[model samples]
Target: MLTPTPTIEKPSNLVAFAFLLIAFLTGIASSFQLPTLSLFLTQEIQVSPAMVGYFYAINAIIGIGLSQILAKYSDKMIDRRKVILYCCVLAIGGCLVFAFNRNYYWLILLGTTLLGLGSSANPQSFALAREYADNTGKESVMFSTIMRTQISLAWIVGPPLSFSIALNWGFDWMYSIAGLAFLFCGLIAVTLLPKVPRKKMEQNTPLQAPSNNQKSVIYLFITVFMIFNCNGMYLINMPLYIIHELHLPAELAGTLMGTAAGLEIPIMLLGGYLTQYFSKKALIFTALWAGFLFYLGLLFFQNTWQLVLLQFFNAIFIGIIATLGMLYFQDLMPRQAGAATTLFSNAAKLSWLVAGPIAGWLAQFWHYNTVFYVSFLMIAIAMVCLMKVRTVN
Candidate 1:
C-alpha cells in the first residue's frame, strides 16, 4: 500500500542523502527563527504580548493564502526543483530582512511578504521527497519518516544553538546564520536533488460531488487542525510562561524543545516501523491522547527536571501526528501529492493563525497556566473528530 509507482531508473542512496541534507539545513533555518521569534518580539523589539500574537497571526494568514496559490500551480510545473529553488531564495531574503531591521512595522511588511512565499518550501520539499520515493520504488511512508527525522536531527542541535547565538551575540547574528543555512540549502537543492517526471494530477482539476475519501479528508483535517492548535499555542506561549510565570531562566525553553525534538526521532522511526502492524488511524488516535496528557502534565510540572521529563510525551504526540497525518492525507488524495501535503501543512498554519491571538489574549488577560488548560480541551475535541472518520483503514 505504501509503494510508489516507479517511472524512471532507480536513484542511488546519494540522492536520498541529498534530501536529508536539505531537510537538515531547512530545519536549522527554522529552528533559529521560529522559537526565537516570540522572545525577539517581546524582549528586544519590545512589542506587547498581544502584538506578538498579531504578528504570528498575520504571518499565518498570509502564509496560508500564498501556499495555497503555490499548491494550485506547482503541480503543473515540469520541474519541482524550480519551485523549491525560488522558495529558498525568498526565504533567504526574508531572513536577511529580519537580521537587519528591528522596526515592528518594517518586519511585518517585508517579513510576512517574503516569508509567506518562503513557507511553501517545507511542503514543496515534502512533495519532492514523496515523488522521488514514488518514482524510484522506495517505501514511501518509511522514506517520508526518514526525511522527517533529518529535521528532528537538525532540531537536536538547532534550538540550543539558536538561543545561545541570540542570547550571546545578538538576534541579528541568529537571523544571519539562519539566512546562510537557507543559502547553502538552496544551492544544494538546485544542484543535486533529482527531478522526477511530472505525473498527471486529476486532483488539480475541478472536483465533482464529495466522495467518502473527500469527507474523511475533511474530518482528518479538522482533527489535525485542532490538535495542532494546542501544540502551536503551547510553542508560542510556553517560553513566556516559564520565564515570567515560573520564574525560570529563558534558555531553559531551548533545552526543553531540543530534548523533545531529540526524542521525536526515535518516536517517529518507531511509528514508521509500526505501520506494518498497526493502522495509522489507531496510532493517530493514541497520539492525540498523548498530546492531551502532555499538556495536562505541563500545568503541574513546572520544575526543571519535570519539564525535561515531560518532553517524552511531547515527542510521542508531535512525532507521530506530524508524520502520520501527512501520510494519511496523501493516501486520501493519492494523485495530488502537492495538494494533500499542502493541506496537511495548512492545518498547522491555520491552527497557528487561531492559536497565536488566543494565546496572547489569555496570557494578557487571565494567566499563563490557562493556556495548558485550553490546550488540553482542544485535543479532547480532536479525539472526538478522529472518532468520526471510521473510513480510515
Candidate 2:
C-alpha cells in the first residue's frame, strides 16, 4: 500500500544547512588522509603492496566491528552529538599520529585502526539525519541525497587541495591539515549542532516494514558486497596504478579521485528528483551497467586523459549508489533506519576487509591493470544479482 505523504513540517533551513556544513567539513579533513593513504604506505614507508593491503584490511576489519557497535548504541541510547564528537577526536588524534609516526609501520597500522574505529561517525551522522527527518516528518531519502551532495562538493575541493599541499609542502603536512579539519569538526559539533532525541514512531506511521524474503535479502547483500568490493579494489590500487603503471604524476591520484567525486555532486543532488520519473530499480541497474563498462574501459586506457574521462562514468555509478543504495535498503528493511544504513556501510567495510589483501595479491602476481578486470567481473555479477530484486510497486 502506498502511504500518503506526511503533512508534518519540514526541517528548518538552518537545521538542514548545519548537516550540510558538517558533512562538508568532515569530507575536507578525511579527503587528505584517504586519497593519499596508499601513496604514503608505498612511497614514504616503503611497504610492499601486500603489506599495504594488510594495513588497509586491518583498518576495515576493526571499522566493521566498531561502527556496528556504535550504530546499535546510536539507535538505542546514546546521544548522537556525543558519538560524533568522540569520533572526530579519535580521527584527529589518528591523523596526528600518522603525520608524525608514519615511518614506523606498527604505529602506522595503529593510527589507521584508530581512524577506522572513528568511521562510526559517518553512520551516526546518517542516523542523525534520519532522526531529523523523522522529527519533521520528511522522507529520510531526501536528507540522504542532500547530505551526499554536500559531501561530494567537499570531495571536489578536497582532493586538489590535498594534492597541492602534498606536492608543495609534504605528505606529512597533508595529514596535519586533515587533523586540524577534524578538530574544527569537533568544535562545530559542540557548538552548532542540535541534540535531538530519537522518538519512537507509532505503528501506524508511514514507514514501511521490511518486506524482503530471505533470498531477496541475500541477493541485495551480495550486490552491495560486490559494489564495494570493486570500490575497495580501486581505492587500494589507484594510486599505484597512476604512479607506477601509467607513469603519471603522484598528484594525479588526488585530481582523479576529486574529479570523479565532483561529478557525483550534481547527480546526487538530482537523484531524488530523478527517482520521481524513473524507477529506483532502473536507476540502480543502469548505474551498475555503467560501472561494468567503466571498469572494462580501465583495462584499455593507456593515457592519463583517457583515465580521467572514464572517471565520469565511475562518478555516475558511485553517485547513484551513494544516494540510492541506502534508500533501497530502507525499502527492504524499512523498520530499522540505523540497521539499513549500516548494512550498506558494513558491506563496504567487509569488501575493503577482503579486497585489500586480495587486490594487493592480484596486483602483485599479475599486472596492476588486471585488477580492473577483476573489478569488471564483480560489477557484472552485481548487475546480475540486482535483477533478482522484487519491486514493491
Candidate 3:
C-alpha cells in the first residue's frame, strides 16, 4: 500500500494569532484613508473632481512601477524589520504633510504620492505572511484566513472611524491619527517579529529570469488584473452612484456600504474553509458568475434597499473570489513571494488606475448606470477567462 505523505506541522498558533492581530491593525490604519481621501481633496483642498481622480491615478501608476523594485530589494536585505519600520515612518511623513498643508490641490497630490510609496506595505504584508507560513510550515489557508479577516475588519471599522473623524475633527486629524497608527504598528512589528538568519549568496536567487514558467506566471498576472479591475470599478464608482444617482444621503450611503462590507466577513471565513474542499479554479468561476449576476441586478435597482441587497450578495461572491485569487497567485510563484505579491498588488493598482479615470469620464459623459453596465461586461469577460484557465495544481 502507498503511504500518504505527512502534512507539515504548522507553527505555533500564538505566533500566527499575533501576526493576524498586526495584519488587522495595519488594515484598519490603511482603510481609514480610503473612504475619506477623495472627500478631503475636494472639501479641504477645493480641487475639481477631475483633479482628484487624476491624483489617484498618478498614485497608482507610481505604486505599480515601484513596488517590484522595492520588493526585489526587500528580498535581498536581511533587515526586513527595519524595512517595514521605514515604510511606517514614510507613512507618518505623508500623513504629516497632508495634515499641515493648507493648499488643497498641491497637498492632496503630494501627500497621495508619498502615501502611495507607503502603501507598498500592502504587498509587503502578504510577503511577510507567506514567510511566516514557510517558517511555521503552516498551510497557505492560515495566511489567506488572516488576510481576509484583517480586510473584513478594516471594512467594518474603517468607514465609520473615518467618517466620524472627518465629520467632527476635520481631515487633518484623520491623517494625524492614521500616522500614529502606522507608527504603533511598526513599533510592534519591530519588537515582535523573529529574526531569521540570512541565506548565503549561493542560496539566494536572481530577481528575474526568463523561463517557460515565467510566461505562465505572466498569464496569471493578467487574470489577477482583470478581477481587480472589476473590483476597483465597483469600489471607486459605487459610492458616487449611491450618493449622486440614488440621491441617498452620504451617511446612509456609507452605512449601506459598510453593511455590504460587514456581510463579506462571514463569506470570507467560509471561503477559507471551502478552499480546502473545492478546486480554486471552480471557486473563482463560481464567484465570477455570481458577480456578473450581481452587476446585472444593479441595472434593475429601484430603491436604496434594492441596491443594498444586491451589494450584500455581491460582497459575498467578491470575498470568495478575492481570497481564492490571492492563494492561486501565491501557488503560481511559490519561490518569489515578494515578486508574486508585487505582481498581485500591481494588478490592484492597475485596476484603480484604469477605473478612476474611466469611471470619471464615463460618469461625465453618460449616466452612472452605464458604468455598472460596463462592469457587468468586464465581469463576463473575466468569467470566460477564468473558465479557460488550466488548473495550476
Among the numbered candidates, top TM-score falls to 1
76-116 per-residue lDDT for model 1 (tens digits): 67677788888888998999889888899988888878888
**Please, what are the lDDT tens digits per residue for candidate 2 over residues 67-120?**
766666555543567878888889887887887885656554678667876666
Clashes of each: 0, 0, 1
> Which consecutive 10 residues in model 3 have the weakest lDDT in total?
1-10
Q: Largest lDDT belongs to which candidate?
A: 1
Cα lDDT, model 3, residue 47: 83
Clashing residue pairs in candidate 1, if any?
Answer: none
Q: Alpha carbon lDDT of residue 49, candidate 2?
A: 72
TM-score of 2: 0.82
Candidates in order, TM-scores: namely: 0.89, 0.82, 0.88
Clashes of 2: 0
- In model 1, what is the error at residue 22, expressed in angstroms? 0.9
